[model samples]
Every structure is written in C-alpha cells, then in structure tokens.
Target: MVAPLKVGIAGLGTVGAEVVRLIEQQARTLSARSGRGVQVVAVTARSKAKKRKLDLRGVAWAKNPLDLANDPGIDCFVELMGGAGEPALSAIEAALKSGKSVVTANKALIAKHGLRLAKLAEKHGGALNYEAAVGAAIPVIKTLREGLAGTSVHRVYGILNGTCNYILTRMEQEGLSFAECLKDAQRLGYAEANPSFDVDGHDTAQKLAILASLAFGTAVAQNAVYVEGISSITPEDLRAAEELGYRVKLLGVAVRTAKGIEQRVHPTMVPKSSSIAQVMGVTNAVTIDGEGIPPITLVGPGAGGAATASAVIADIADVARGIRAKPFGRPVEQLRVTSKAPMERHEGGYYIRLMARDLAGTAATIATRLAEQKISIESIVQRHANGVDTALAKGKSSPVPVILITYATSEDAVYRALEAVQRDKVISGRPQVIRIEKN
Candidate 1:
C-alpha cells in the first residue's frame, strides 16, 4: 500500500475542527477517491485546553504553528488560521519554503500576499490551492482557475459578503431599517459585533481583488477598488428600486474595459428578473461573463464552518491526487500589473433621489442642470411634501421628493451636474445616487 498523506492543521477553530471531523469520518471514501489515505498527523491552535468536539487521538501537538509547517513528518500544511498578520502569514510562508503543499481559507491573506506566496510555492516545487478562499463551498475559485481556463473572461462579479447581503435582503423584504436589520443579523451571528469589516465593503473588496486577478490575469489590487458600503441604503431606496423593476444589492463588480480593469464594490440596482437579484439571505452568488459561452452563475452558502471546511477538504483531496496548478490560474510572475480603470470614466445609468424645494421652477432648474451635462432623463417622478413628511409641510418652504432615472452617461458628467445642483442650492440636504446595473 502507498504511504498515507500526512496532514498538519494550524488553528483548530470552527472550520479547522470540522475539517478534522470530516477527514476522520470520510477517511475510507477519501482514500478511494484520491487513491491515497489522508491522515491527520499533527495539530496546533491558540488553546489546546479549549473543549473541542473532535477526538485528537494519536495526533501530535506542535507548540507553535510554524513547527507544524516545518515538521518533516507532515506533507501538507492546512492553514485555517485567518488573518493578514503574524503567525498565519509566517507559518504559510515557512511551509512553502520547506516544499510542503498548502491549503487556506484566508481571503485577506490571499488577497494581500498571494502573488508572493505563489512564487514561493513554485520555487519550492510544491502546490498551493485555496478553493475555500473566495466563495466558500461554491467552487468559484476552481471554476475560474481550472474549469474555465480556456475561455476569455470579460467580467466577474458577485455578492461576496453574507453580512451585507443579509442586511440588505432583510431591509428590502421586511421593510426594516438598516440598524434594525443589522441588530437582527448580529443576534443571528450573521454579522460581527463591530461589523465594519463586512458592512463597510472591505470584505467584499478583498474577495473581489482575488477574483479580479483570476478573471483578468492581473495582480491583486485591493487598494484600487472603489468601495461604497450599504450603510447609505434606506427603506425608501429599496421601495423605489422595487417600483422601478429593480432590486438593490451590494455587488462587487469587476470588468475588463478598454481603459483598464474596473473594480468597484457598492450598492447597485439590478434588474428584478436577473438570477443574481434573486439570491438572498446569507447565500452568496458569483457570475462569470466570458467569451464563447453564456454567463454562468454559481450560488451557494458563502460562509460557515461546514461549507468552508468542505471547500478546504476538496483542495486537500486535489493535492493528495497530485493535482497542482498555479495559485491564480497562471504563473504569478506572468500576472500583469494592469492599470485601474478610472471610476469617472465608468459608463452606466443612475438612480438619483433629491429633495427638491417646493418653490417655482425647482424641477425645471434640476432638469436644466442635468441637461447642461448632456445627461438625458429616462424617467422622473415627483411626490408632494405631505406624502414625505408632515414636518416639512409646516416649514416656510416644503421640500418634495424627486426621483430621476437617467440614460447611460459618464460618471464624471453625473458628478459635475450634481455638484452644480448642490452649489445652486436647488435641493435640500445631500442627494442620494445609486448606480443602475443592467444584467
């Protein structure tokens, strides 16, 4: 019989512990599938005394995670320790340097240091697989890196963060306020206590950076992404979207444009009939638009211990079967450093909501400002102040809610026109602008 593939797991947290359980329970089946027995030989975590559900049995305990990475008895290092800093980074680096294959679910670590790690792994004659990094259990990374390798990918986008998606879904479906929905999400453990990392669009941006690299053959550019969170989304906006035959979703969108790669994360109005708009709750979805094939969308549970562990195990099985591929679908050294397509050059329709003063010619002035920028209005709707607020009706000059949908226009034109409107004081307070995404 062939030697069993020795495994060392660092950070026995939720996903890590589940991985151990699944490996033990499915050992015989995994051996049959991969043609090699996969065994857990060593483990390390922040707390060994912490009560766990799994049986460690004869597994060796390493004092440090790096010890497991450098252990000669271990053939593969599984990194479940998530973070962009210390221990996880150093240990994974050491593992690659020692010619040991690695599997990780850390999106932040991969987004920030993937190219360097890929080069390290290639130099050491070892494999680096991260099927669990992007869209947990959805197989998005594998689909892009291997399954669609022959196609010319034009665009890749998705709802990468479950917390933001959950909040937005509840707000639209239940008419709950952002804060109310966020509180409920926190109670349900869908969002973190702080929630800034997930709610502020940084999490989606990190995942987008990885997907953009895979889709466009560019180096990961997390900083280049224009991030706008879902905090600004109101119940009123959701209602307006529904009325306009659209659904408001926080999307991480990347496309290869003539200017360069356009990467952005923000609240977008997707058509109600689109498959992406139908995905709700904590579920995640990714759409790949490529050449020679219709757009393919992969949707599933984006996060959780079991789902993420399943993806990690898939990567492990591939490594055991001697399936080695470049980390980002291609060699790291060959990945281009493409320029970021300027957001101002982005061409798309927009939904603008304004509080117009109920004075004479208010609508005319607004129209003239937009027309001066050569932006044509597709539709416009106005409601009386009485319908919006009773307090506004009692004021010296009540302000009415005016919503406008514009034709495809440059972002620079919209910004310039809105700025002029603000300077002229034709509208009260800040105007709400949401981009309209046509599927």
Candidate 2:
C-alpha cells in the first residue's frame, strides 16, 4: 500500500477549513490519481475551542502555527494565513528548512519575498508551490511556469482584483456613482470591510508583480511598481468612457518595454467590446503575450475559499506523485531582474478630466497646448458642474467640468503639454489624466 502523504495546515479560518473539506471529500480519488493516499495529520488556528463543521477528531489541533510546522508527521505544510509576515512567514521558513514541501495561497508574501524563499526551498530540495497564490483554482502559475515555458512571453496583464472589477461593472450597468457601487459591493459581500487593498489596486499589484516576474523570469518587486486605485473613478468618467466606446476597468497591467519592464495597477480604458472589457462583476481574467502562438487568456473567480483550496490540493497531489518543477518557471539565477521602462517613455491613449471655464477661447487654449505636444483629440464631453457653474459663477467665467479622450501619445509628451495647459490663465483647475489601456 502507498503510504499516506501527511499534511499539516495552518490558519483554518476560511481557506484552511476548505482544504480539510476538499481532502476528505476527494481522498480516494486523489489516492488513485496521485499513486498515494493523503492524510490531514494536523491543523493550526487561533482558536481550537471554536466550533468547526469538519471532522478533526482524529487530527491534531495546534494553538499556534509553529506547532504544525514543526510536527514530524507533517511531510508538507499548507499556509492559508493571508499576510506577508509573522506566523505565515515563520512557519513557511521553518517548513522549508525542515525539508518539507510548502504550499501557500498568500500572494502578498509571494510577491514581496518570492526569490528569497525560492532560493531557500531549492537549497533544502523541498518544493515551494503556490498555484493558489496568483489566481485561485486557475493554475495560472503552472501555466506560466510550465505550459508556456518554451515560449518567450513579452507581456502579462490581467484583471486580477475581484472587488474593483465588481464595483466598476456595477458602476457601468447601474449608473451608480463610485461610492454607491462600492456600497453595493460591500453589502453583497463582494468587498471587504477594509476595501483599500482591493479598491486601491494593492491586491492586484501584488498579483501583477508575481505574474510579471514569472513571465519575464525576474524577481518580483511589489513596492517598487507604480500603483493607483479606483477610488477617483467617477460615474462621469464611466459614462464618458461608454459614450466613446470604451470601458474603464481597474487593470493590473505589466508590459516589458525596451527601456525595461513597466508595471502598474490603475483604472484603464479598454474597448467595451474586447474580451477583457466584458469580464465583469467579480470575474477575473489574465492575458499573456509571446512569440508565435495566439495570446493566451484565462478568466475565472480569482478568489474564493473553495477555489483557493482546490489549488492547494493540486500542489499537494504533486508532492504525493513526487512531481517537482521550478518555483517561478526557471532557475532563480537565470531570472532576469532588470529596471522597468520609465513611465515617461510609455505611449498610450488617455482620458482626462479638467474643470475649466465655460468661457470662449478656454477650449481653444486647451486644444492648442495639446496640439503643441502632438496630442490629438479623439472625443470630448462637456458637463455642467453642480455649483461651480451655477451659483458660484459671476457670468460665463464659471468652471464647467470638461472631460476628453485623447489618441495614443507618449507619457512624457502628454505631461509636458498638460503643464503648459495647467499654467494657462484660461484653465481654472488641475488636470486628471488616466491611462487608457486598449491592450
């Protein structure tokens, strides 16, 4: 009989508990498929006295994660804890050093410190698998690491954050303001109480760093990458984008430019009819670019308790079947970690909103400056402000909100032209420029 591959899981809040449920439900089939049976020997969480539905009667329950990590019977350590530091970090370090395979769904940890941990795991000859980390149950990590290994991937971008996508979709469909859409998402449990991580694009930024590193064979850099949130996205922007045949979606985008790699997370304008533009309401999608094959795209629920656990189990089955692969597609040394292209050199279409005087020559002045920078106007929309144009204006000198879409231009050129327009006496306020990602 094949010996059972013992498992030790930490953080049973949501994902860890789901792991137990999956393992119990699929034990026999997994044994047959893996050529070995799997056993849940131990679990760790903050509270053991709390009620749990699964059967833990025969399994050990540790008050602390370290207990599970150090257990001799545990041949593999599963970390479901959601942070980049603390017990999760310590436990993973302990497990790898103990010569045990480690599986994690912690994208934050992986994005922040993947290369270091990969080196340690390789030194110990134990697998450091995180298929669950990037896209839940999607196996994107494996696809990039193995399936597409033979190809040279040039760019990897995705709509990785569920909350932002949900909110943006709601805004478009219901004509709801950013705040109202966000409130609806919160009420539906699609967003967290503290939604900054998702709404502000930090969550997707982490995932982007991970995916970009895999695609480019480079070390992931989460903090160094530029980040922007969806909070400033307004209903006006949404309506304007729609009228212009565009959709504003919060995208986690990464492109390998000649200058270097450009990584950013922000609300971008994608064609409403494009594949990525149609991925609405909590659904996730990733697009990969490379040489010779059709662009590979995978879309799904990037996060869910059960979906995440499914990826965890797949990694464990690999251990059971004695399968091992590179932590991030290639050897750590061979990974190309280079400086990304400066944003100034990037050329892409843009959406801009500015509060300008409704007087004559104001539009002409704005146009002239953009013209000097070679920015061509594609579309424009004029909307009266709530009070700026009403009770506050002496006459036609009132500042009306003007929104415009521009054809693709270099980032540097746009900023230079904007500087000139901002200083022009004809303009009344600062300009807000949002990149249009028609990728």
Clash totals, every prediction: 0, 2
Q: Write the per-residue lDDT of candidate 1 for residues 1-439, one digit (tens) a residue.
A: 8888899999899999999999999999999999999999999999999999789989999999999999999999999999997898999999999999999999999989988899998899788888898889999998999899999999998999999999999999899999999999999999989999999999999999999999989999798899999999999899888988999999999998888899999999999999999999999999999999998999999999999999999999998999889899888888989666678999999999998886666667788999999999998877674444232232346677888899999999999999998888878999999998888
Q: Model 2, which residues run further than 4 Å from truth?
A: 381-401
Task: Please provide, for model 2 over 226-254, each residue's C-alpha lDDT reduced to its tens digit, 9 standing for 90 to 100.
Answer: 78899888787787788778898888888
Worst 10 residues of 1 by lDDT: 387-396
In model 1, the runs with Cα more than 4 Å from the true position are: 385-396
Candidate-wise lDDT, in order: 0.91, 0.85
Model 1 whole-model lDDT (C-alpha atoms): 0.91
- Return the top candidate by lDDT: 1
- Local distance difference test, candidate 2: 0.85
